[model samples]
Target: MVTIKDIAREADVSPSTVSRVLSNKKDFFNPATAAKVRKIAKKLGYRKNTLAANLVKKKNNIIVVVISSVETNFSDQIIKGIQSEAQGIGYDIMYMYTHTTNEEEHKHILETLISRQISGILFVSVILEKENITLLDAAKIPYIFVSIKPDNEHMVIGSDDQEIGYLATKYLINLGHKIIGLAGVDAYPYAGFSRIKGYQRALDEFGIEANEKYIFYGDYSYNSGSQAIKYYHENFSSLTGIVAASDSCATGILNYAYDHKIKIPEEYSIITIDGTNLCNITRPRLTSVTQNFRKMGSLGVRKLIKLMEGKVNTKNKSIFVPVKIDVRSSTARLTR
Candidate 1:
């Protein structure tokens, strides 16, 4: 275990200088002396004791990311954005998964994070209960919600899901799709419900009657997409276009269509939300309303940093990243 004292002895500089140089606080040190200290430390195979250093300072430059699971395809992009931004600013990222729905288990996770002395937290696609919120508030740690909008007033970073739904639905409607089916959009998480509202709003603007039978509410999963297809086939035979909740759900719909020998575009045009790389790989490709996932992540980190720094006017404000549509082969003008 090489220490700063060992490097200081070899470089003939004081331990304080070595510590400052190694920690990147070198503005007060001579450039050549700082360089020599770094060379000696590198030669001695020195590694930082982050936990000990954080203990001494009573805080850490670590951001904890909490997610239910890495089930969505766009999660990777969001993480990439977070890492890129956090690393650039000399912060470390720690991922924690919340698999249990139990409130006690959720409390344990929050307690563990607080014990770590982390600088802040980012909640990705995981909604915290009121009790958990109270715990976080009591701890006085900064946290920002990402990707999902909660009912309470909190700092959140994500797309306008209602606009996403309206954009996807209206694209098909403009292409002569009057009888559109919506799949895998459940009635929870402000995002889901807002998207449903957006879909209905588009229909009403176009004078098309919104039918409840045309909507399939399901968890945003591949299985949910498959079941939506089956349900629509049996219940709504006049469906000519579909708007999916996510790229994975859209892929599931495509898979069901292939297995059932349903001709895409000729039979039904489809558009999905969450424009991840998966959209390009699907057969015929998918037309998607792309959320700025990476931007959401990067902006969340920036906002969290502000809150951690105790910047005034940073709390209680939510940011909604803009979304756009990427036209592709999966959606076409309805000719039938």
Candidate 2:
């Protein structure tokens, strides 16, 4: 292996000088000496051992990003944000996937990260249970959450889910639909619960009774949407509007409606959250609440960096990005 000693000898400099140059210790050497050392190191094909080097420095530039095994369009956009921000600050990302909500996989991944002494971790839509959090705390590995936040106040960032829910539900109400139903997925507690509350709040604002019978919960799979719609049809046939938890779920309902020959808009109006590309491609096209997931990811990395750097706020801090509704063909005025 090409070593610093070889470069030092070839460049007619001491090993210490070569070391300083290779490590980019700016104050340790003159410009000419640094330039000479770099030139000779290149010529001699000397490769610095990153692992050994980091061992001495007690630091690494790698950050681990934990994501769920079931990938979503929102997940992809958040990843792009993370990549852009991490690269901007001289850090690299290593993706780790959790096969399910099982905490064992999470524990194993956390242990691996701790063993490797990775610089930091960015959790994308995965919430760490108390045990895992305790482990991370003991290991002193700073992490930031994106797309989801735990009960504790910590460095986390996400979109304003309640606002999206309110806006969509209110839109339906404005179109003269009173018997509106909510089609929600059971996944993502932070997003799902907040949105449900928002839906309730909008109903309360308009002096409408909050009925549990009108709420349908799904597993976030495509089948969940169709099944929820079927349940709604059988029980609450008077349902005139729906605020779906996700675009994928909305698409499922749209497909079911087409298959069952249920006329949209004339009979029912629908809006979904997470305005991914799937919204535009559906037959009638879906109106959706758009959250800037890319920004959420970028902000999460920045927050983790701040924590890693020992920047402290008086209390734990979280940033919430704003959301907007994208009007589309799937919704219309109540014809009845």
| Predictions in order: lDDT | 0.86, 0.82
Give candidate 2's root-mean-square deviation (CA, Å).
3.0
lDDT of 1 by residue, 42-153 (tens): 8889999988988999999889988766345767888988988887787889998874234677799899888877888998887777899889889988888898746647
TM-score of each: 0.89, 0.86
Model 1 weakest 10-residue run by lDDT = 97-106
On residues 1-336, what C-alpha lDDT tens digit does candidate 2 reach at each position? 999889888888889989888878878879999988888888888887988877777777788999866534568888888888887687778998884366888999999889888998988878788898889989988888787766656656888777877898999999889999888556456767888888989999999888988888875556777887888888887789988888778888899999999877677898888988888899899998888889998888887888889895414677888888899998999877
For model 1, the local distance difference test gives 0.86
| TM-score of decoy 2 | 0.86
Best by TM-score: 1
Indicate the residue-level lDDT of 309 in model 2: 91
Minimum summed lDDT over a 10-residue window in model 2 is located at 312-321
Using lDDT as the measure, which candidate wins?
Answer: 1
Evaluated against the true structure, the overall lDDT of model 2 is: 0.82
Residue pairs clashing, model 1: none
